[model samples]
Target chain A: MLERTKKSFLTALWILIITFPLMGLKTVFTGEQAEVGIRADAFYLAGVVFLCGMMWSMKGLIGRGIAFAVPPAKSCTGAIKTSVMKVPVWCWQVGILAMLCAFPFMGSEAELNKYFSFLIETLIYVSLALGLNIMVGMVGLLVLGYAAFFGIGAYTYAILSLNFHVPFWPSLFIGGAIAGVIGILLGIPSIRLRGDYLAIVTLGFGEIVRFVLKNEAAVTGGEQGLPNQHIPGAIAAPSLGFMVLDREIHYYYIAIVIMVLVVFVVHRLNNSRTGRAWIAIREDETAAMSMGINTFRMKILAFAISAFIAGFVGVFYAARMNFVNPEAFRFEYSVLILSMVILGGMGSVPGVILGAVILQVIPWLMRDMMPNLLREYFPSAANVAGTLTDFRLLIFGGIMVIMMIFRPQGIIGNARRKIELGVEEERD
Target chain B: MFQHIVDGTTQGAIYALIALGYTLVYGILGMINFAHGEVYMIGAYIGIISLAVFTATGMTLISLPLCVFVAFLAALFFCAAYGYTIEKTAYRPLRQAHILAPLISAIGMSTFLQNYVMLAHGKDKFDFPGIFRAAFINNTVQISGARVNYLEIFIIAASLVTMLCLHLMIRYTRIGKAMRATAQDKKMAGLVGININRVIPFTFIVGSALAAIAGVMVSMYVGATKFDDGYMAGMKAFTAAVLGGIGNITGTMLGGFILGLAESMGIWLISSDYKDAYSFILLLIVLIVRPRGLLGEQVSDRA
Candidate 1:
């Protein structure tokens, strides 16, 4: 009764807030010469608000229902505790709202587009990190060939969409499926290995994939890469009563939506039976196998799922960047992703997100900010200094070392996760 | 094709030297000692610096023994210090922790050492002076329509001498016997009044010096040395060590030659860019098929 009323109230409040922004956007764009579709913004906002409302209501219901069903004294303390919290929900809401609000603040149209493009790129990394976290964090599988899946995804989209003229949406799924299959194939051999051996094998796999991509020039276009990929018609135009897909903000919304979907699915999977199986295998494979769990199957599943996510992101990257090249997928990228997973906290989702954002944005931000900041203060230093990118690899390597020495558990490692990582395990 | 084999053998000899360091440490310590590669890099840089100083004073034609003596001393001291410090600071703490922790630290040390050199010296490839670049003998042995450079002979000879010395040290010396005992069982060695600590450092010093000599030889052959050169060469050498049954000295040497030959043949058959890929692919296949490596004992008792 009270919960129902509260949910209704929240939903109404969300709708009203979204409508207010929609109205503001409509009026602002009315006088502009750009063929901006105010309706699309309204629709997107409504969808976002509705999704938030649903998640909020679901959490409320789950919490109260669990409390009602499981008597406080009788129920296990941990079981009764709510996993869904308001903090992450609010963070997501506030972040998205802030980004959406910035749409109207751009002084010029070009700046607005650039901002949108940046958001799309951020989304790609977010998706990739989430996918990688599945293998490295959740499963405790140290896959050095993570970028191979990304390549698989990219190549799948490139070959299918470019050669077969498949629509972007369908090809995206196909790419993910193809990469997932490849991941499983790789994971099969990986089941027999552990630790360093596993790392070496995956590293080899990554090289093999890269080599094949380079050698199969007839199909992959070799070093030149596939260019001028076509974006799907649905997203290409302002259709389905939505605004045209012209602005960077629209692409940003698309990326955000995809990231949200990936995050939601991964979060759910992390708490599922399959997720528990992965954890069990990671903890002790021999013991896990003794317990009737097929360790090989579970590992393969984790790999496939991770690869699928990478594939999904790859499709978006191809569409967003409108370019695909082997240079973008390199061992360095694999190392970068691995660093993100390590630095952020191996098993923590939020930590992976934090790592991704820092790794992706810091270098670019440093590149832009350092030169001007340094120039204004010390004019002579500017003349002798090279670009920040020049020292980026060195800085990154230094950080990896420092982090390993001081905080191998990563920045936001969970206590239980730390223990499982062998912090508490006694050695002979 | 014959010339390629000769070149491969020459390169393989250098890899064999570096692989000896990896194999020696792994044999004694049961640790990867990832910093071993950086020791090679540092040794090369030190050799170049020492040689440059010597050549500036017109001692370009110094006696071979004197040159080897100075280079060996520098390599021995610097590498020993590096190896000891790495063990004490990075590894000793994590000895009881998860295996991954030390491995990560090793990677960190490798990166730190590489970058330390890069920053100290500008991020550019430094050329080794031409003092040792001259061929000791100018004649080429023609075999099956191919010319084999006589420099190959010197590399093979030098590597053989080093290997023979190492073999003698391990088999005949008291320190060598202590090392073997420690490798077999650290606790037992300690109980038997062997200074395990002393033996470990000695192992490191010997291993690192070998790597250093290999580094100088490689830089000489390649004509230039980059601060980041250790990554590729080190990886290849490490692969050789793994291929040769990790903890076995003779196996490591054999592994180096095999890997070198494979890489050379791969370059001949395909593109040079694919040389690394081929070696790594071979490593992957070998690891999957035989985790124990060639000539390695089946230690199926481990959990």
Candidate 2:
């Protein structure tokens, strides 16, 4: 009993020592002016310290008591797997297609525009996530600077279209090719490195790309960024007025078609011999190399292909937004895309798409739909919902933390990743 | 050239301070504490408030040096608690989880903290009151056509003192021995009866305290700080850590100084518009030329 008391006492004391100085310092020193006097602020400081001490002690006690409980598995992988396996793939595809095709027709014009915008955004991420999955999910490379390719793709089309009056159709290939070349350049240097080192190196490349884009005013339009990005007018289609790519509906359809094409290619690749080689390298590079696989070429192939897909979507992104800016390609955006791939289930195509849609669509729905509903039923609550929108990123960060902790395998756990993560757990 | 060197040294000191935090944490845990930057950010905010408290209490009652010491200590204390809690909440549970889990958690914590600070302190930049506004600090000493401010001298001196103290502690202390043992091998350390849990959090506390000192000095040096200041500073410091060979304390210090000088000189040679790019380019160069870093021992693939 005495020992426990002594331990708790020590814990509280340590907490007190650490908490008082930093917390009190802030209240005492306002930046420009002294707002609250020291004597007045002393109580607040003391209260905070006491609270911290109490919390620390409680944690010590409660945490010990709870330590014996078996931890729940991080994700409902088994449950999801069983349910997903029960559904036939064709039914799932046809039903999804039917719903997507009928989406715009069901909503009011204003609602249709909003829904189309969301769908277009979703499609863009779906393509981006799928591309990233090739490197991160299949190749097992954590590419931290993925948005650099996205940036490259956008900038390529923007520069080509704006400068030479090149149309969007050809620019897409050019942008993808440019990004693919850059990806190879990055991948070659990174081939020697693994894990976090490669992650940082790629991150550095991404930043360099951003800086160059921001600095080269002559070509990239400097910080003002390339505005009024030109995309080709849509081709005439049966039963549709001259489909203008700038219009939301036409762009949405084009994006959907591209997204489908990407998914198909990715699915085909995931089942091919090359895909197996990539996964083998991901599992053990040395083993893969020893097995007569050219690990270097395959790794670079993953980078090139992934970057191509990113670049492909980049042209579409520029067209959809009708604007291209350095801000669109920040490190944060890369992390967000990576998070989508991770949360959905790394290496799972359907999982990543599900992850992207859930992350991207839910926030908008919460911000736009929730407040309107609340404002009608409970007017006062609407103001609270409005303020909650500001915390979207905060919630995203929380989700990332929670998801990683609870279910590192993600929403749709791949068989390989599940085994790997499981092996990791038993080692400790 | 002399001016750039002096500026670089001051900048280098801050980077060294931040780099040490990364190195210490990395040494103990293979995971990168991505939220370390946000911890520094929190420290700076706390430093601002602590300064306000000290000023409100009236500095006339005590010597200026004592008042300054008190303010720094206060900031360090609170930042230590923050570091402790951060590890407890974000990292501790993931200790045995997948490798990527901790990294993702750290990123999430960073994102959360950045936005949290933004909500607490408005998005705009806040002017950090120049407590050293006295002639002693503002006065410039010219040496060989180079103008050096006394504040720069103070910054360098404080950084050196902190680093020296850390060096002494790590070299001689029992806790330091335990930390080294644990870092060398956690399971073996546990077998040797060393408390891994305690050592880990203690390492966090010490790293955080160092970061807090850096945060205060930086806010004072720059004259203004924004909520987003930590991101750039953290990345540069992380670069320094990697350049020096991650987990090598001495290497981190040397790396920080070299990076600072390179950045300063690079900005002078090229346009300052690409100032952020300079460090990243240097990082890439270092990565390609010598992946292990200058002082880093060869670390084979753990797999």
Candidate 3:
């Protein structure tokens, strides 16, 4: 124990020295003067580093104890597959739907906006993740700039609504259609390239889309984006025939409905012949072509369909937020969405939703929601509550690296994909 | 046109410097080192921060050249260390994993590095000490017919020397031969007694060291550096690597120049507002026409 403690101290000291220039000294600009301030958080960092080193040293001892609590993915997936079901799958799905429908009522009347908005946003992401899953999971196309389509769908609706006074209902279909058309156009020349090359092309395309949106000041309002913040009530809330969706609860119903429709469409497509052809192309394009699969055509179809689904959420998100900005459509946002798809195990519907929820909620909880809740409920532990807020993204990055290192197949990844990703070679 | 050529060549040199790193890593691993751009960005930070620290400690007062030299050395050393550590921690374990694993992990690492700098350095752009600019600020040289600033000329000359040194090192050195052997066939190279582990980390170290040169130079030239600047520059360098043929060293250098020239000429012809679009358009056209880039490629079909 003493030896481990000594080693931990050495590791922490090393970390401090290595990171001294960057983390220890901080540059703070006040007015016109620049000053370097020593960050007091160095001690905290050293403590954390020491703990990690000790944890590393005692891995064998801890592993046995932790193994029983958290099962390996192989066994976890097997448990899901072989476990006895008390009720039918459809009944459970219906139960979930009913629960979702009753979400607004579950929350207090005053907090309807707060609670429903959260659910609404979650549902929107669920839809987006499912849409991205079409191309990434089923079709096997890696799109680095899927957010461009989302931005397009959003900007299309926002522009049409604010300028032409077009209703949200009609703009939904129009935006999705426009996005799908753009997808087909994008996929035409680029789809012929191999997977890795295609990744860069898509990345470039995404950058081009963002740059164009930023550059075209007149159309996109440049960096500030559409719907000027200074001018309130310029853009109205989305409306049904009865009334405008002026509250979060109203938007919640629409989001859940749209999400279900997306899930159904995606589920149907995944089991369809077209989906199989796309998978064939992904697995081995040459073989797929030899089998007369019309690989290029199938690839294009996947792009269009996936882009279409992402487009729907883009419209809903813009309408719900009553704002559209180029900032929302950055490469980082695309990375976040791609993380969702990859985290969920690419082609699995439930996996994608679970991945979306975990990535979304965990970060959200760390950044503001959970911390605030903790401060409100437990005043004594306030110091430790939001301490993780600043490092949420750093923690997130570390998690991604660790997750990929240990389980590249992802949590509840597709069985075949799990094997393909080499997660099963450990033979748990 | 003459002035634009000088500007293009200077800018292209920087891109080429960064692109060499990308192509070299891709040659070895057949995976895109997504955090490479971050390494370059971090290089710039290290350079500037070191200068600030030196200036604060009265080292610059003692000897300005010595301080600058020390600063450059610090930047190169730290960046190379970062590259080696990143590869060891995030990537080395996933050597046999699927392509997506390493790619996503690199992206995550890139994000972490960017945010780490952002948190430490603050999100605001910081000014470089203008060590190089002092010599080239007002000095202009007649190149062909155009009056080119010494800084631009210096950038071009520095880039050429760096590339030449890299070429010589790779061509003549034992480590270079080992690297080439590993790139061609890892199994064979291992059979022939080359340590794959040593070669991979060495490749990252060398690439990162080259990126440090570009980072310091660009920070010196631009006068300011931001945390997120790497993403775009990195993308363009990756584009350059692909345009030249991804794994080919000579081709990447040529690709960087072509892209730089194309962007400069495009900006001169069109509006500067659409500066970023020119590279993408050029990339699209080249990809449509050549498929394998200008010099062709030697990417292994394994992972």
The candidate scoring highest on TM-score is 3
Put down candidate 1 lDDT per residue, B105-149, tens digits, no spaces.
676677767866675456778676554565443557877888766
As for TM-score, the candidate ahead, 1 or 2, is: 2
When only chain A is evaluated, what TM-score does every model earn?
Answer: 0.71, 0.80, 0.87
DockQ of each: 0.12, 0.51, 0.46
lDDT of 2 by residue, A181-241 (tens): 9899889887788777788888888999999998888888888887533334321111233
Which CAPRI level is candidate 2? medium
TM-score of each: 0.77, 0.89, 0.92
lDDT of 3 by residue, A238-348 (tens): 777787776767788889889999989987887789877877776777788899999878989989988988787788888877878889998888888888888767788
Q: What's the CA error at residue A351 for candidate 1, in Å? A: 2.6
Report the lDDT of model 2 for residue A84: 86
A316-426 per-residue lDDT for model 1 (tens digits): 776666567787888667777877777677767777777787777766555555665778888887844464546655565556666667776667675556665655556
What would the TM-score be for candidate 3 when compared with the true structure?
0.92
On TM-score, who's better, 1 or 3?
3
List where candidate 3 sits over 4 angstroms from the true fold: A1-14, A26-47, A63-88, A229-236, A378-387, A416-428, B130-132, B298-303
Q: What is the TM-score of each candidate's chain B when compared with the real chain B?
A: 0.92, 0.96, 0.95
Please give, for residues B1-303, the per-residue lDDT of candidate 3 as tens digits. Answer: 998988899889999999999999999888999999999998998888777776655566687667767877898898898899899889999888766778888988998888888877778897876553586757887878999887787789988998999999889999999999998888889999999999999999999998988998899889889999898899999999999989899999999999999999999999788898899889888988877789965444324
